[model samples]
Target: MELVSLNATHPDHGGKSFQKAASVVLHLLVIAALTYQIRGVARLPAHPHIDARILVPYAPGHTAVVHPPKPKIIRPKEEPKLAMKEPPPPPPPSSGGDPTGDADVELAMASFFPDPKPDLAALPHGTRGDIVIDIVIDQDGKVVDTQVDQGLGHGVDEAVLAVLQTWTFYPATKSGKPVPSKQRLLFHFERA
Candidate 1:
């Protein structure tokens, strides 16, 4: 007994293999034609056109569509009735000595004119003179008024007055309160 292999490479089965391959190719060609015919039927020839128009309503026969009335115009009213209360009267004049008689006044005087003695440089050429300035020390410990009693021609008199203006004193007191008092300062100028 002889055995025959059915594979395409086997001599006995080569012609049969060729016939089977041809039938498979013919089946694929028929399937491709059917797919193309179905796709054509599914497509429409032309797209439909749509005409769109936006319509607004026109007022007919004076139809009154009332809108809310405008808010009322309000004017602020003047309140003249409101009045400010008066400030309490100044605290009764402080008790002890004049409140104005404080250490600050003395410090201010010292800072204003540090040198109590007048500089004699103003007098020149052997000029010598004595000046007495009548000064009033006010309650604030400041020299308020200065009257020159003697004159020194070489500007010595004026220099004395100007320097005294910056002088301050423990204003004379009466009954523990600062009081204005008259005092005199004597300046002697003699060139060295």
Candidate 2:
């Protein structure tokens, strides 16, 4: 019961042959710092130029010099000239009569009718006719343009041009100011 002595030598430590010569000088200073970092990474010049190419098996005429990659001219960016200030000369020719000349306009007074009658009950059970629309009212009385000019299909001319585009007219005049006329709406789609 007394065999314990791993090459026994210890004056407080510094002994097994000075710890085997300090572990062989710390393994030769870690192999001389790993051979000075592998000779400074083998003198450094190998970033990315390794063309050891030797693939020669397609022998018929040996044509592989392909170098078509130099067409990148791309040049279209010239757009910065916006000083246009000549649009103020077009609003002085509007004093009453030739508001684009509907030629003496004067017949557009059916004030507003958000939906003044056009449900003909979805017309189909007999669908009588008559849809004629030609509107164009606008001088600010809106009804800008309808044009159904006699349609009466079972859809009742698109429900009387969608109820005459929510009709809103009273702007037809010429010698008396507000112009822009032209109105001829007669929608009668009786479908009892």
lDDT of each: 0.61, 0.65
Q: What TM-score should be assigned to candidate 1?
A: 0.38
Local lDDT at 149 for model 2: 60
* lDDT minimum window of 10 residues, candidate 2: 36-45
Q: Give the per-residue lDDT digits (tens) of candidate 2, residues 1-192.
A: 899899986676756777899999999988666443221112213534543323223334565443433666877699668897766555554443544664544666887776446566665777687767787877778887777767866565776677778778778777767767776867565676
- List residue ranges in candidate 2 displaced over 4 A: 1-65, 68-110, 125-130, 135-148, 153-171, 175-181, 184-192
> On residues 1-192, what C-alpha lDDT tens digit does candidate 1 reach at each position?
888776437565778888899989989877655443321122122433543332223344544343343666777797457788998888655434435564322211222554445566766757777777787878888889889887675666666677778776766655555567677667666776
The residue ranges of model 1 lying beyond 4 angstroms of the native Cα positions read: 1-113, 116-124
Model 2 local distance difference test score: 0.65
Quickly count the clashes in candidate 1. Answer: 0
- Candidate 2 scores a C-alpha RMSD against the true structure in Å of 16.7
Number of the top candidate by lDDT?
2
Error of 1 at 100 (Å): 25
